[model samples]
Target chain A: MDRRDFIRTAAGTGAVLAARPGAFVRDLYAFQETANLSHVEARYYIKLPDREIECQLCPRKCRLGDKERGYCGVRENDGGTYYTLVYGKACARNIDPVEKKPFFHVLPGTAALSIASAGCNVNCKFCQNWEISQVRAEQVTAYDFPPRDVAAAAEANRCPSIAYTYSEPTVFYEYMFDTAVEARRRNIRSLVVTGGLINPEPLEALTKVVDAIKIDLKAFTQAFYKDYVRGDLAPVLEAIKLVARQKIWLEIVYLVIPTLNDEPEEVRKMARWILKEVGPGVPLHFTRFTPMYLIKNLPPTPLSTLRSLRKIALDEGLQYVYTGNIPGDEGENTWCPTCRTLLIRRNGFAVEENAIKGGACPSCRNPVPGIWA
Target chain B: MTESLVVIVRGRGVRSRGGEIAPAVLARIYERGLGLLTGQTGAEEALRTLFAPSDKVGIKINAIAGRELTSPPAVTLPFAGLFSRIGIADRNVVIWDRTNRELRAAGYALNADGPGPRILGTDTAGVGYDAEPFVHRNIASRISAVLTDRVTASVSFAILKDHGLAGVTAGMKNYFGAIHNPNKYHDDHCDPFVAELFDAPPVRTRHRLTVLDALVVQCHRGPAFHAAWAAPAESLIFGTDPVAVDAAGWRLVERLRKEKGLPTLAEEGRPPLYLQTAERLGLGRAAEADIRLLEDEV
Candidate 1:
């Protein structure tokens, strides 16, 4: 009981078991006290010549040396100056539900705030957050929460967005690019999430300050990104064609995993390579694999394999295909590829009804592409 | 299929005009390299043929290159004082690594139980890492609860360098500091994730010996500490075939990078192909006709 009094008695017994209602409360103050961490100075790296450096922000350009550390153990190179020890050091904040970052066309049943920090340039043996993405910002227990206090804790938790998310926000890319330029100076919205390994000039400068990135992809063979995602499906299909030629909002997910990446011709060649590279209104999802970390003897995914891989990414035309983690399955909803009309419904990460009036499909007004208001 | 002996030794003046380390010529070069890697002429009968005075041991080391290339407290407290000369207890011999601020930035002196042998780290206080993750093939991690629940005989003791990515970070990549992700096995060049993390079962069922600390051999842009390819090489390699003491510390860091002309971790492409994938996973003998080597000096 001395890691700062076990994180101040597990953050005062997680604020008195987060106000008691079902009370099993265990964020044991998200553990941290691994000597506080955060060293800062990191950004697309370089410095080489003896004390060594390299990093160029992902695609594993690592190169480090003087006290090395970059297969994203939250960056470090120290004597040659690379740094980023989980910059604003959050480790795992919360709020959730931008459809549980199943963005399902962003801003649906909003909330976000998410956060995260440790590390992860891809080690995904089904890492449902490998205790903070396969660890090493001194093996977790963070909480400084910088970047303008993560945009003032997403405007004091009324949170219109600000996710960066559960772990691999591109190895805390300078604390998610300065908490997406301080949650875009107040009107919130920053999203991100990631696994699209990165580095196309820092993911084209994080698609000019985040807003909706997502990208899990996780398997469309390079032999399942070299046997179970140590990483490299061509830099996550060039970070989903650099976040669909940026102006933000791009989704993806995948998960599947039953006999490792639930094949069906690798989900119809990853839905015909995300319908010929990030097109066909990119929403995707599929999601369902439940066997936690290092993939516990495969079992969870099979609600008819996420409805036969969401009918092969919606019969390979891919107009926003869905189906994640099975919650009352009508493949989770969001229809009207042109008047099929359910236009956003969802149940698990709860949205329950949207209807899409102006962003279109109010019974066939047609348009539907994202950030719906 | 038989070979694997190794040994090396050297020691000579064992460094002193202030560079320090001469704990009696590094304890007669770790008692003549554990009496020639255990043929036994008494370094406490070659550590009672690898410990059993109610075992416990540990020693681990390689303090992440801090005080000019780590593993120093006069070379790992005279090899943790040969495990209290075999009856193992100055509190059951610990030593460790993976922070006590890198064993107090390599000069050491932390001693968890207020005694002689315990020099702490695995982050100390209720020692860390190992709340699961032991996995193996393509190695999942979390080890270092001081090598899975405080030693039952281990040793590694690393520090022979030139690694700019495992072409030569000796003694089986020094058990990548006994787990907790050695930067996710420095990809490919740390091949077979440093021989599947020394054939994992927490360092292959509690290792036994290996030693290395090739006295200041950084040999060129190494696991950091450059000082002009830092080469004193007062040696000390030994082995219990942890891939023939890191393939004789990668042929003494390619003979001090071919005496400075450099270029040959396979002509600079990062050649510790995890010692032929730790000898195709049998976990020993990385070529040179399967290692018999030996040497000496002290």
Candidate 2:
């Protein structure tokens, strides 16, 4: 049978078996499909002396032998040929509010065609979507959703933007980039909901096509990142800086965990860094963290914690500091940086009233930094 | 720890006219190796020593590299057949790997046959992974239900080969088949992770033996098949101590590499650090002084 039929049959049947925490991460060693995964030659990699290859996709720089996969569990080296297995093979697809992506400043309250393929560079302990995100390309059910089909679906669904989200978009860069190009052709915007752990070359190219990018800052201290995220904070910071510098409407979301990353001192440091790097105007959302994945022992971030962090960020001169995942909290509304008028009134992803006229505050006429159309 | 006895049993002309295993020689190989491992007694007592009659044994095979370089059905099925004849119920034995396609490629008949030892992959329709992840140390993964809920004991029936990154892929590294995220653990020449993973309860508690399929050892440019570098070792290595078994397997690969005038895995700077880590964890002895190696041919 064709892979498409196989996937449908596999997923349609009881094949969607409940997973036990395997001996290690959710790489799905048992879902051994053939080279059904894409062999589209990857962009960032160098040929070694023998028939080996080094993947320069992320910080791992996984120097793989003939048939080994990278740390991301997606890319591979086949006789010195590097390839990404999860190019167009999306595992998760949903119509999500752009606010859920927490792109507070970019086209708020619009529905986005959000999609993700399996695999990620970093393994986050608190990943809510580990069932799909932490698995290998073949482990998760893959569909034949190529670039054009993705764009067509977004247009059909009345979505103004396509968001590469849920899983790390960097693992599926080629597919996301192609879809971004296709979406651009159809006059639909492409937004990247990423952890921002990608290398510079890919990120630079992605910014050229995507309209906006929302980065999950994860944590402030490198130690916290190293311990919890299994990824470095420096590269993520570098990515955010690159996105901000390219003037690609960038936003940052820092999920506020109770004790893990919720230290007021660290929050203040992150806030100060943001002010210095992206300036005060770029939207920053301090999201509430829910206990999930491997971190079930920790309690979810309290409502008061999000409020206090928002206060801290606002105090540090971040103009559009907001509290997320908590509905109808005063921090949900965007106040004009100049006149302090509520420019965008939001109540749980629904735009109550837009007071900005032509991308500017109606009262003060100060330009609000966003895609106002 | 008990005396870790590992026997490398080589069969005369083990590979047939078409490059597949000679079933007669293959059967004798298991018989002879099991005989040595069970104190020169026989295969029946060996099976008893390894598993109880009521034990539902999972024979985890490595079939990722395809037929020639993978743990072939010819080698694995005959071993399971030996266990079945020795009074372990056929229904209690399963010869498995990560996926059906690779199992099929390696000449395994993917079966859910109720009457006999079944040959299957984790992707079998009703079985996938556990709904919740089991976190052990640095590992957080969705384990296959076949392992968690189906099998009572496990055996890593892995292929021995020269790994480009991890120095050598043997019995210990073979448990990579058991986890969802083997890819994540390949960093640092797959050092403490492999050792630590074996220490995890799901593996450390349930594991019973290490059977390395060394008949067509990929001594170089592996765990993938490279005909230029592949050798006909025509042997299988068996041991109760997982670390000693893998450490011994590493030596075999190094021997083959030295024969080929190639750099030792250590010279290449990718010695199996898992052996050292495994030693430190007191999993088993890695240095030669601690191991007792026995060799024979069927």
Candidate 3:
């Protein structure tokens, strides 16, 4: 594929064309022949004897020997010092609607300048952006988009917020944290889209900079996590609770897959846990699942499944629950918990009307919890 | 049942003081190893017995740790030259690893065209990893095009070393370089994943031989370079059974570790359990009793 195909501006939408799941080439880019890797020393790693180091950035805490990379395929251990290879290397960058990140409650009807480097801590079987997330940094073409440049581009594009998205942002924690600092200096909000596999210390540091975070809670059971996601469910749950405890706005997306995580009892239990731990005000998005990456045997989740799961979450006392990936559905609209009035009308990513005035419901005058400008 | 044979050919002065392989001694070691492996008097006869004349062969080398501890070209090139002597076209053989940088760091000149045994990496312009993942058991990864598309037959030419996670990385673990995401499989001491990755169609169907470069074995604190723990074994191990070869290499590592007063891999809680998993999958024998090791010095 041509390198130009990776970076293109869409007509009229002002959204750069996002590279799809198969757009990446498995070969290293020609410029990467000399290895265009970053040498910035990583944080949260302990030096061991004999030139080994244990990375404490995420739940994996990967102990690596000299010249070995972590599970993320980006960070490396060179002579007892850990360094991130993807710092300031942008593999995918685009201007997207904040709703595209599925953060309906935070900065809706605005553009988010989204960026991601190559690598993810976990290997989710159903990764939709595997082209960018599942491969090593050299396998995909990357540009030198530094932290300052990222914030400048967001301002130039008139984007209110900059999103560390597409790939797992936590894998590029240093880059994301520094960019968030730069974006905050420019009065631009920063948003994070991640799998929530980060350790508490890093998450606490990250919470101090970013304005909003959307965690993709893959499943509730450890078995589902082991079988499909190749990660531990408990750490993800802990990360979500940790982020929720902070002052930053938090949202959750649970992709409901058939015969995997769509059991009614499991969904009910997850909803109840979220209600009790994260409270009812946090918006929960039950997104539809499509067959992608390593999981092609299963079909796209039926619209009925998303609705039922959303109903389970709503019945468990979540104030703002929405169904995603099925366009024009009524479940996409947010309703006031007090009087059942439509607080925000949304068709796919397009917002028709939002009746929440000054972070309160117009009809019932109940407090709606979100970042309303 | 007959025991599987694993030949250990030792060279008296194969490794020079500068850590470079002496080409003549390395060739002698390979000749002796291949002769014993095929029960033939000549290396060319042994090559002819193992591979067809028209086969496009891939000499997959381990170069992840750079030149310090890698399968050097001085060892593998002469070994590939044996195939050329036996009528396999020089243009049909490619000595490759995961990346050009790693291969270059391992002292290999990058050559993708016009020569004997085209030395290159999977990152070569026309040779990358296959776009579609070859899913097998718990493995869903893109195999290198060198293994999946370009070469009809393969030889795993790997450096023997003690791995931090895999306990001991040998012939089978060498194929980890054949995929795009080896970092994902390093969990659980590389058990079942290493065996399962080898069981994948792209690897299992094409693999023909395991020639381990044991000139300098890093028995402790490795798969990396630690000068204090490295031993100059000056040997080349050859076997047709992939698991049996790695199992023997594991014993060699354990021997060195014991000599240095280090704990056994099992005592350290990382014993390349993948060999047993491979045995269960009918890949090869892992037990020492099932293997017949023949040692001879060149």
- DockQ for all candidate structures vs. native: 0.14, 0.38, 0.57
Task: For residue A77, give model 2's deviation from the true position in Å.
Answer: 3.0
lDDT ranking, high to low? 3, 2, 1
Runs of candidate 2 exceeding 4 Å displacement: A1-36, B16-18
Docking class of 2: acceptable
Classified by CAPRI criteria, candidate 1 counts as: incorrect
lDDT of 1 by residue, A204-258 (tens): 9878877788888877888878778777788888878978988889988888888
lDDT of 2 by residue, B1-298 (tens): 5567788999988886357778888878887888898785777777888788788889999888877678776677778887776577888889887778878888888887766688887777667667666777766766776788779889999899998768898888877877778898876888778888888888888889899988877888788888878878888898888998998999999998888898998888989998998899888989887888999998
What's the true lDDT of residue A39 in model 1?
A: 81
Q: Where does candidate 3 stray beyond 4 Å?
A: A1-23, A26-35
The fnat scores of all predictions, in order, read 0.36, 0.50, 0.46
For candidate 2, lDDT tens digit of each residue in A111-163?
88878888898889889777667877887766668899888888877789999
* Whole-model lDDT, model 2: 0.83
Name the top TM-score candidate: 3
lDDT of 3: 0.88
Looking at model 3, give its docking quality level.
medium
- Name the weakest run of 10 consecutive residues (lDDT summed) in model 2 chain A: A10-19
Question: For model 2, what TM-score does chain A reach?
Answer: 0.91
